[model samples]
Target: MTDVQTDTTLCDPQDMAGRLHTALSDLVRDCKARMLRPRPGHQPTADLSGFRLGITWLAQQRQMDSMLDLAEQLVREAPALVGGHGRKPETLDQLRACMVPVLRALPEVNRPPAQRLEWLFGTLLVDELQCLPHAEVMAVLERNAFQPRHWQYIVPYLEQNLPKVKGTGLSWQGQERRRRLLGYAWQACQKAGWADRAEALFRRELSVCACYGELAELLVHRGDVEEAQTVLLKGIAKYNASRPELTMGWLDRLESLNGVG
Candidate 1:
């Protein structure tokens, strides 16, 4: 449950990785024992609670390949117990969540770049990759951004989903979610040294209304409060009539930036 800072120098990667690996191994062993002792004519249910606990442990470990083999094994064995795809079992989801951060931090190891990339984006795992949480996706992109193929894959995947946010017919919740996704993706791209690409994406796809709200927040975090205010003001003017509540929120942000309202 402790938050491990992403900095490798602050912690011992080997010790942390080994501890998590052993913990996950024990969990799988226990789950296997439970699966074998099912009631007569009834398949035993797989307990997923330990998987989440493993994921929490995995998240604290700095990104490293020391645990990749363990992750691959878990992924291979997960489907038999927790069927994925449309029926994304919680165990499989938790497994993917744990494995992604490790994969993202794999750049420190001197593995075969192409082979590791293939393993990270494996065919059997691509579907599950789409189901990764927003934070995990951003972490993966940020960690692998230096790799041309990784950057190439993430940018297009996000761009392809941009069109769905173009129209104004979306419900407020739908629009808000889209805005957050795009905004976080932009932040990820920027963190990967793709600020130009992020800006281009904002201009080409998200330069309006709620998306501007996202942009403003990004700027605010970047300490460009004035620019954030400008973006929100523009959004306020544009969305005031049809999206009054959203605009009001934007205006509130704008005024807060100026120490007013």
Candidate 2:
């Protein structure tokens, strides 16, 4: 019941690679020129037309070395281009818009895997943090799988930012972002073997959001089955009228935990 389309024409990989390199080289040149000399009253722009498609095509062709070479050029040049204007929000926003394709491609291109972590924590999260929003920065983290060695960097950044996000004004959307950030903080603490900090963060999140199902899951994870059951029962009662689907899901989880399913 499915239809498929196939291409039968043959294309030269070398020609494709040459064109991709030429495009990236042009981008790097344009970025450097703009950074070195800025025009008054005009925002600098880099045309990223076909950039992502080029990178994706090269990656699909399994030309990793070529992709890495292009990525490193962008990584080295981007900070200078983005930060050349000294963090003026408008200028930074303009620069970030130009660099998004490069940023999104870097994680896929860096070799040895750990190199990606280094670029992410040491460069993007630290130096380029000013140009990026927390959500965009977190997107990079969400995309990549990191190891225990990353805990040293990840935990500190999460700890530092959690309070700042918490201190934002009382808006529903802001509070929602805070809850999501708190979840990351809690997970980072737990992964770093800081069980007490993790537990405290979980409780703090519960107090803020009153997402009792999550609290119950945490308690169940720590072997507090009776407490978890109590929490889930409370969740089911609270949401049963307003959020029947969520209540049913929590009921299923509770029953499974109690060996009732």
Candidate 3:
């Protein structure tokens, strides 16, 4: 998102509404379960929390058809509770169910960006894209969303799926964060006197994988190709012991740079 877009998304009400829907649904479900005391006639005094939550859920709850039956039961039995004032609970919102199934849909690439992002926010609660098809997850990531929250889901996602997602991290707080992270990674390498001390420091601090082929570049610039190569190899070996793909990517970059590929 550009500056204007980012600023605009920060205050979007529909986004807030969806989030509110989830919160109120959870509250209503909890209250319903809480008042399940024995003897239907025995009603506790009306609690403000319960009333507010019930009102909100009735007004805004969406999705999650699974709770519809429960909602029906609550409504049917509402008259039994004297303190509740002879009211029936409304239908549970099916659109509000942030269940595991909806997260599997990757509509971003094929649909409007806003809609895709909306779907992603709901899916954020789903288990890893492991349950999603690889092709579908790839498609979702390829498209962009105005939602920074999507990035919250994206980082761990890339880390979990590709292992290439590790980075020194974006220090930039407001939007364009990924770019700032890249900049810091490069700057650290440049200031380390070709020791790759910066990249190493970055990986240690940020848990981001050091950039591929960066170590030797640092050493080569310092006029010590051999020592640099050794540092690069050994560093990569150690990294490989823990993060083999990272090590492999660096090794491949090294070979490619040397025209061995």
Candidate 4:
């Protein structure tokens, strides 16, 4: 992860619009179809709950050391989860059973020196606009975005050594295409500013299969207590529980937002 300089706004509106336009154009070329119309708003309340549970369950599944092969097996059988939600587990026991391998392996796969993001993310950038799982990925990204203090466990990797496997930058056309496409998205994001992304976070349609208590809690920790409170209230109202996990996540988010402490 790059060191976040400051909480500077990213992707100014004018910049983001242009980037969005360019991304949409590349998307057309890649998909070779009429572009899908985009309607903004977060995920539905119900889906957010489902996604929240799904990820929680996913986190619980553990695999480690000698138990490691199970990580590969889990992805092979339940590939849908690599991206987003699906049918809930039949029972608490089943849920735990499903997640154990992943839980054990996460120490190994989580982003960093042992970064196995490649396996989970596959060929797609979790941050990419075209990916269906983007909303969930965005939550993960936001949780870590410009907030590096929490990642003390994962050893850092040099950005230079990290793979840029997206396009072999050899050919002129390939280089140009990559430039026009990614440059536009990044420039747009930087220009549009972080506020646009923050607004995107609050939308229910995009926040589906998500958790708000934690998100709200982060705002509170940041002294944006009102936003934090709102996120938590909405989450509890929707889910009908004041879970410790959510509580802890909120606190952690706040702590991280505040800095390494």
Candidate 5:
């Protein structure tokens, strides 16, 4: 039997919206202040803190307009804030470091139905996700696990924006991002008890080193050495010339397994 709980008192939506706006207003103010007097290094201590506070409140409120407004503003200003055009790369890097968290806080499943997911904004989000330090990516992924529907938006965004790998020239950063994205997406599926979904996602593309590594490792751990060997071989053959180091590592690991080294 399902137990049901009912709300005894309802909070006014308008009041919640007001509070959301106020919180976001403070975040925006802090962003500008921090931007004016930039901090040392690419560490975004203050700006990230402010964005976290506002985003936490925004999530609680579930106010789509407020969330979109903040997201749009941040996305629009990012290139400039990052000092696009002949500006110092260091400054842009620092700015990006500061903005990554704020951008990650943008609501995915809670986004308004009316809001069109722009490719440019999606591209920005992917870039931010890729550029974020590994530790931060894991943290974001941990949060994403609780929001299963977020993958509905995030996966499509990635499919559209994540460039396919080609030729012997590989963008290491892009590959790393793809690997992390796949890891998170697969983890999200697995956590939801969607084993088939996880397999499909992990096998969808060999765009990154870990895509093959993780899948192969899982298979090997599950006593499917032949399948694991095949997965690893395919990965090595496909990526050897372009990413010899990573593929070679996978090869070494595959060789250590019994049969079909």
Candidate 6:
């Protein structure tokens, strides 16, 4: 009888680690080469979904160290991979995919808070509005506590993206996502004791989307009762025909403001 050879390499942790590293390195090289030498009118694409799958596999294998290593490498390479001149919509989508996993994993990874914050602000949040969608990025922020330094990025991001929410030819779904993100941004600003910024954001959103109910609530919170009443009236008039439910809700609030109910 011929002796049977069992393949032990697949089960060896050390070998698996080496293989993972090699695979990731090769992926990075391929992505970088594509970025460096782009075909005309062809946007370079990163296999972000595949990359996320690999990260998930690493997590399933309980390879925490390898996951962190991959996160670090991704953060370091992110700007180069998706940034610079002639960025197309496709590139932003790729950036969003690449950063989503990194943002989710960084909090759990054993890293210094300062270093993580540096990565968050310096690398990820730099021109974040361009690279990330309001909803996905805000979901990550909602999960984490707001740091004071976060205001610097958060303010500018809100300012830039809120206007795009309305009259930008977005679908209803797109508008809804931006509206949800706006709500989260308002709450975050309030939590961070940036009431002024929160009010500003509400006003900015109102200018773009006529978010009267939201802005009126904020105004009432800040003791601007008269303005709140005016806003509610405007909302009642604007939405009464098309959005009866919303108008009814605003009417209730207005009645309360007037001590009528």
lDDT of 5 by residue, 11-113 (tens): 4545544554455455456556665666666543223333334434555566545544554454445434343222355544544454454445543545442
Name the 10 consecutive residues with the lowest summed lDDT in model 6: 1-10
Task: Residues 149-187, candidate 3: write the lDDT tens digits.
Answer: 534333333323332332213322211233233333343
The runs of at least 3 residues in candidate 4 whose Cα sits more than 4 Å from the true structure, single-residue gaps closed, are: 1-102, 105-114, 117-212, 229-261
Largest TM-score belongs to which candidate?
A: 5
- Judged by whole-model lDDT over C-alpha atoms, candidate 6 comes out at 0.59
lDDT per residue, candidate 6, 139-217, as tens digits? 6566555466665455566566555443232444444445555666676577567888888787666645557888888
Task: List the lowest-lDDT window of 10 residues for candidate 3.
Answer: 91-100
Q: What lDDT would each prediction earn against the true structure?
A: 0.55, 0.56, 0.38, 0.34, 0.52, 0.59
Model 4 accuracy (lDDT, Cα): 0.34
lDDT of 1 by residue, 1-261 (tens): 122223344556566565555655665665566556534453444454443444434445534355565566665555444532223365556666655655555554456654544445442232322334556545554554356655555565566655544333256655554555566557547645676677667656454325877777767766777877888887788779987977887877777789621
| Model 6 residue-pair collision total | 0
Backbone N/Cα/C clashes per model: 0, 0, 11, 38, 0, 0
Clashing pairs in 5: none
TM match of model 4 to true structure: 0.26
The per-prediction CA RMSD against the true structure, in angstroms, equals 10.8, 11.9, 17.0, 20.5, 10.6, 9.8
Q: Report residue 214 deviation for candidate 3 (angstroms).
A: 12
- Candidate 5 lDDT for residue 29: 63
Model 6 regions more than 4 Å off: 1-55, 59-106, 109-145, 164-171
- Rate residue 39 of model 1 by lDDT: 42
- TM-score-best of 1 and 5: 5
Give the candidate number with the greatest lDDT.
Answer: 6
